[model samples]
Target: MLTVSNLYVQYGERILLDRISFMVGDRERIGLVGRNGAGKSTLLKIIAGAQSPDEGIITRPGSSTLGFLHQEMNLPKGKTVLEETLTAFEETNKLEERLEVVHREVATRTDFESDGYMNLLTEMSDLEHRFHLLGGGNKQVEAEKVLKGLGFKDADFQRLTDEFSGGWQMRIELAKMLLQKPDFLLLDEPTNHLDIESIIWLEGFLETCESSVIVISHDKMFLDNVTKRTVEIELGKVYDYKASYSGYIEMREERREKMAAAYSNQQKVVVQMERTIKRFMAKATKTSMAQSMQKRLNKIDRIELDDEDTAVMNIRFPVPPRAGQVVIDVRNLTKKYGGLTVLSGVDFKMDRGDRVAFVGQNGQGKTTLARILVHQLPPTAGEMKPGHNVHIGYYAQNQAATLQPNLTLLETMELHSPPEMRTRLRSILGAFLFSGEDHDKKVSVLSGGERARLALACLLLKPINLLVLDEPTNHLDMLSK
Candidate 1:
């Protein structure tokens, strides 16, 4: 079991975690959930030893290993997907090489009774045992299986990591972590880049994998499918439920209802006690009784209600300008980079106010098509025509990363927004959960989810007849999604 005891974390004056405590049993699947910036990732980082808590200890057996796949990891550029993933068995490979050397030494040595020879034999035996424990043999086959499960193709296995987009690179990292098969796995937003098919495959993989997992994701259905337990972080406190995501939701509502009723009853009792105390105090002979009643009231433990952030986001897209019957028309549209053809002879048309969803495996030209429609990427062959007076507002998959890192949150919005929209910039950002000091925060300092929200907020600054979004809800929190 992995135990986090009285984990306390603070940032500035804000208490992100207040002596939170939880334990994850062996092979337990936990879903870590919270709103954006609620310190869900921070708690995971503390458990993984990537970041330290203000005061706490995480206890796990010495034999158990931990693997954490965070959002901001940087993959090596030169190595192919398979090569990078195989590195997960680094210790295993080393043990195998040492075993070979020892075998050759044993065969060449004639002194059978020598202590040195005996020690070599002992080392070989130990190495073989450890290597088998680490799943040393068939490393390539295991790596390939994980890669394919993460939506990587056979051709992609040989391609350099840098050749893939950020989302695909994230998959490569996830594949490496899965191949490691650690005892405790901490996955942060594992489904952010995956398509529906890959997400389903991952759900099945996690369900069968013999690892205690704490997955932080916005996809409620994904959590419902894979996790058996749910740990929620809210108001600098932790709530643990012995149920899946959906079950937790129902249980949480019941808990809140009970708490609300108890609080209400307590308030009524307190009010009656106060009135009695006031009446007693009016008569001089009953002053002592009033004093005793006041002490009783003061000693009573308050039935405190859980403080929930019920602030609903006031997100409203600008009214789009009217356009012709057809918003966009594509005929035999094709896009290619070098010799790789992402989209070939694809034909699609969107009438005014027509909503369409493009779903496919990663690297299947979803983003490519969206970009081409918005005129960000020119088609290599064929043509795409816009209807009369059609304006396009595009939200790219890499929108968060594309923001200026040095600029403050408010500045980024103002820089991209039109002069007429400047007055409404703060309001729009507030609606997206960027308020007060958050507006002054630099883009570089924001979390991936926060950056994603900011990017989506920026998109609503302008009005357009056609709006194109590629994986827009990937980084949003549950409420935002």
Candidate 2:
């Protein structure tokens, strides 16, 4: 079990978690949810001991271990995939090393029954016992199982991790974390880079694993299927619900309704008190009563309502400008790195107003083709032609990274807009739910979803006939999407 008491985290003057506390019992599955900037990731990082909190005590059993899977990480290179994964069994690996040390001592010792020699023998026996108990001998079998389950083939096991894409590198890290068998696991957006099949496999693995899991994901279906409880952080507070995401939404709505009613009743009472004071102010006989009523009004604490930050991004793709019948045509498309052909002999054609999707596994050239179509990359051996007047707007999967961190939301919006179009900035920001105080927040401080909205919002600054979107929905939450 894990218990957090009196937790307080601050970002300058803004409170991320204000005296918030919660617990994750053994074998429990928790879904952590909140708006993009609501400190969900911060709370996870604190619990995993990846960072420190301003004030908090996290209590756990001495035997318990934590494995935190952060979103951004760099895996080590110069080792084969199987060799890298073998490092997860730290206990067994240490035992094996100690045994090697004992063997060297035994080889040098002439007196086998001496006190020091006897102690070395005892240590070696204990090490072997613990190693065997931890399945040290079956490291290869276990590693292969996990690697294959995560979509790595047997042949891929011998390849250096550096040869893989960033997504696959993250998978290697994930595999190592899984093999460590921690008592508690913290996963932040684990499925963001996974394909559908791999995601489903991971969901099954998470369900059967004995460790307690706290997963932060925007996939509503996955949350409903895997998590048994939901914990939401909003405005520096936590709301605990002993149900799945769907059930939590229902209960939360009911809570909002109750708060609204209480606030309305308080307003009515305040209005009535004001009327009574006004009516009695003209009479000298009721002066004391009027003063009494005024004092009561001054002492009253109004019931605060929950004004949830559900910013609506009120915008749509701009209407397509005039273009020829055929928007783009590709013939004999091929992409290669050295001798490895990622895409070969591919042909595709897109006419005006024709919707298409290039869906496949992680390294299956979907983004490669998109880049070629957008003229970001030249094809090695293909003819990719754009029809007359075909203007393209491209949204790369990593578009969020291009945002200016030091600028405020309103400032960034203005930077992307033309001088004459600057008047529509407020309306545009409002449509995307960046209104009032949200407009003043720096781009560096915005959440993943918020940054995504802002990046897409920039696209509306100009009109184009065709839009090339490559994983444009990477960091968006369900509501934001």
Candidate 3:
């Protein structure tokens, strides 16, 4: 079992985690959920011993081993995929070598009854046991099995690590960790770059893995399929729920209802006590009762409801004059870079009010088509036409770079908004959960979520009949998405 007690973590003056505690049983699978900056990653780092908390005790059995996978890590280049995967057996390989040395010495000895001989034989037996336990007998076969399970082909196993992209390199690192077979695994956003098929394969692998797992993921379906429990971090505290993602949502709603009811009851009691004290202050006998009631009210513990932070992006584009039925029509669209073809004569159409989601592999040209539709990039050889009265509002995935970094939140909105809509800027900002000091913050200082919200706010300043959004939910939280 692994346990955390009274964990506290702070970043300068800001408290990220406060007195949080939880436990994981031997084979438990836990899913950690929270907003982007709610310390989900920080907690995983602390558990992995990569970062120390301000005050806490993490206890695990001395015999346990841990494996951690972070989003960013320096992986050794110029190594083949097979060579990298085989490195997990380095210690076992050394043990096998030592066992070979012991066997040779034993064979050369003429006297089998000698004390030293007996000792050497016993040590050799122990080494053989451990070697088999570590899969030294079939290490290469096991490594290939793990590689294939992670979507790597046998033909690609000998390819150099540097030949692969960053995302594929991350998968190599993950493959190595999975092969290690540690007692516990700490995974942070393991499904970030995975395709739908790869993600399903990984989820199945994790489900049957022997190690205990604690993963932080934004994919609700993944969590629901893999984890048996949900651990929620909110407002610098942890709430443990012994159920899957859907069940946890039900329990959270029930908790909120109970809290609301308790608060209402307490308010009624306080009001009645105040009225009694005001009406009977002059009567000596009743004055004591009123004083007792006042003291009881003062000592009562108040029920504080969990404050839900609204999404900082409330995007509602102003409606432009109605457009024709067909907003965008594309035909025989083909895109290529030198010898690599991204899209090949793909044809699609978008109506005025269609909310379409393009799903495919990372490099399959979804974003490329979005850019082409918005006129940001011209297609290699195709025609795209907008219907009558169609006005487009384009949102790029990297809006943080597109928005003016020097402008404050208030200024960015005002610059794009018309004079008549300027008066409603504060209300619009409030809808996006930006108010008072938040509006004064510069775009450069905002987080990814904040930048995305500001960019969406800019879109709402103009009238648009069609919205071409490219991964608009990339930086958004679960609720925001």
Q: Which candidate is the best by TM-score?
A: 1
**What's the distance in Å from true for residue 170, model 1?**
0.9
Model 3 lDDT on a 0 to 1 scale: 0.82
Ranking by TM-score: 1, 2, 3
Residues forming the 10-long window of minimal summed lDDT in candidate 1? 309-318
Residue 313 local lDDT, model 3: 53
Quote model 1's TM-score: 0.91
TM-score of each predicted structure versus truth: 0.91, 0.81, 0.74
Q: Order the numbered candidates by lDDT, best leading.
A: 1, 2, 3
lDDT (Cα, 0-100) at 141 in candidate 3 = 95
Maximum-lDDT candidate: 1
Report how far off residue 251 is in candidate 3 (Å). 1.0
Tens-digit lDDT string for candidate 2 (47-100): 887779999888889867899987667888899999898888887688789888
Better of 1 and 3 by TM-score: 1
Clashing pairs in 3: none
